[model samples]
Target: MNEHDLRHLEIPLPFAPQRHSMSDRAQERVQIWAMRFGLLADDAAARRFESLGYARFSAYWCPTASFADMLLVAEWITLFFVFDDLQNQAITTGRLEDYDRLRHTALQVVYERGVTGPVPPVIAALSNLCTRTFPRNSVAWQRRFELNLELWLIGHARENSFRQAGRSPGPAEYPRLRRDASTVLPTVDLAEVIEHTELPDALYFGPSYQEIIATTADIMCLTNDLHSLAVEYDAEDTINMVTTLRDHRGMNLSEAVAEVRRLIDVRIADSQAAAQSITAEMDALHLPPRIRNGVRRCIRDCQSAMAGMELWDRTETVRFTPDEELGATRAIDYNNGFLDASELGRAAPADSRRV
Candidate 1:
């Protein structure tokens, strides 16, 4: 890959995203449910959460779905953040075994309906989400989510192992890990849930539709990798695409970031094309109006999610801030410091980096 001097880049977004009305009520519901679910560990955690601005983040993740469904989306988004935070802590603190046990226990809560005894707050929250989300959806849909959740936790475990061993994934291996490591797949599952559309297995598994799903997931992961690059660098995390390209491909930081941006455009274009193919296929089938509408809604939800991800990053979120916006109010180390391109020269190589 040819290196580009992208250290001081301000690349424009390559796609036009649909706009959805954001609800403060939905954001507030996330905060309320977050507390009820024991999403925070303590007062200190709460303070740190405020600095992270997850309420706004959750709002962005949820589209213009109904109020009830938005509530569900908000809760799900909050639960994911809670789970991710705990998992990251485990990895950073060298508690991989504890993280594994925690995920296994959480999966138990998800699978066993009656095993509702005491568990960790994150597990309890997930149990509630699974119980609430599964009943309205198909068993197959629930299974998809269960498998995706499994993959997510497994990816986290893999990352934890890497962290323990001081290893960073190469470019070839990074995307596979990212598919599970990030919430990309789960977010697709959420799109189905939020749309209240159980897409027929035939359409969902078809090559063109699957392309849409994969491309959309890639877009989500790349968008996040771009927006969160600074924060991840600040935390010395190596799971980001930027770092992976730089380390494995011998590109500089600027080149890696530019490549990530280019990949974002490519994925978005592929997703758009796949979406058109899906529409054409739906037309050819001449399916029932209900099924056709549901399929369209599912595709729309995925597009809306992509738009949300893009819009959220450009906003004043705590995770992606300008260099002048230094000095966090809370006492937290995870991406709590300022970052600029100048810091790249001072950054250690991939092997020396750890979260």
Candidate 2:
């Protein structure tokens, strides 16, 4: 197979003797697949990723996790994986003009939203990965890496669009979204990955789901921040993700509500646009029905979520404070630091390059 085909590939379980227990054996399978394909980061990094929750929800291979509460998480990830696969293909001698359009559209979103609109870590890491895999100046390598980064940013916004759309109001043009993949790979033993990174368990949830509900939760957690960007943006340094905006004005009660409404409007437009794009693609090319259906569901669900999300208000947050600002501020500051690290190149000042 070509390199593009291998972009999101998973390895088969590694071989070991001594009759490991079922769970350990299962975990070994996860390792085998991850290591063979390079998914297994250093143990400490993995730990950080898991500790931070990246592993819990985004380990795409283990299907047992559910996303019911946050079904969009699963959709966004599934979408990310697909986009990654497609980008790999594009970079590896497969080009689709529409993809360029998509990438630009996403960049537009980020530009409009400003610095807080994007995250960069995955792109940077993937670029580093590409440098290791292909010769410098390889168009395939450059495009492939570029596309992955773009998709991650777009996925960041898209997932929120799904959440803001909320649960279906019952059989609109697009039905509510759901996934049964978690049933495919139920147990994701991440101990090995945890040891390698500082990523934290939230990453695990991004890819962990035993059923659809859990998968959705994972997906939602990843994207819900966009819908609740207000919460994350305006929250005290103790618990906010949009740190640049943490001290910025306009995050107060009334303004936050207004932003939600405005975001929902944009999401609705996005939903319509994505659907149109997919439908146009369908006119000439044939794709797996499952993917088409999945796209349809994600589009509809996210649109609905966006609508309901407009109702999100500052009231949802607890405003009580201690006599003075406490160390709790670091909770969000730390997460933001991680996010900045994740952005491709210098989402913040300290985001220096590392192998």
Which parts of model 1 have CA positions greater than 4 angstroms off? 1-11, 14-22, 41-44, 60-62, 283-286, 321-326, 329-355
Worst window of 10 by summed lDDT in candidate 2: 11-20
Q: At residue 333, what lDDT does model 1 achieve?
A: 31
TM-score versus the correct structure, for each prediction: 0.83, 0.30
Q: Write the per-residue lDDT of candidate 2 for residues 26-144, one digit (tens) a residue.
A: 33333333333333345643332222222223322222223221222322332343333334333333243433443444343222222222443333333333333223223432343
Which number leads on TM-score? 1
Q: Who wins the lDDT comparison?
A: 1
lDDT by residue (3-102, candidate 1, tens digit) is 1222223445544454436555566666567667566546676666665655555554445577787778777766666667766676666666666766
Q: How accurate is candidate 2 locally (lDDT)?
A: 0.30
Local distance difference test scores for all models: 0.65, 0.30
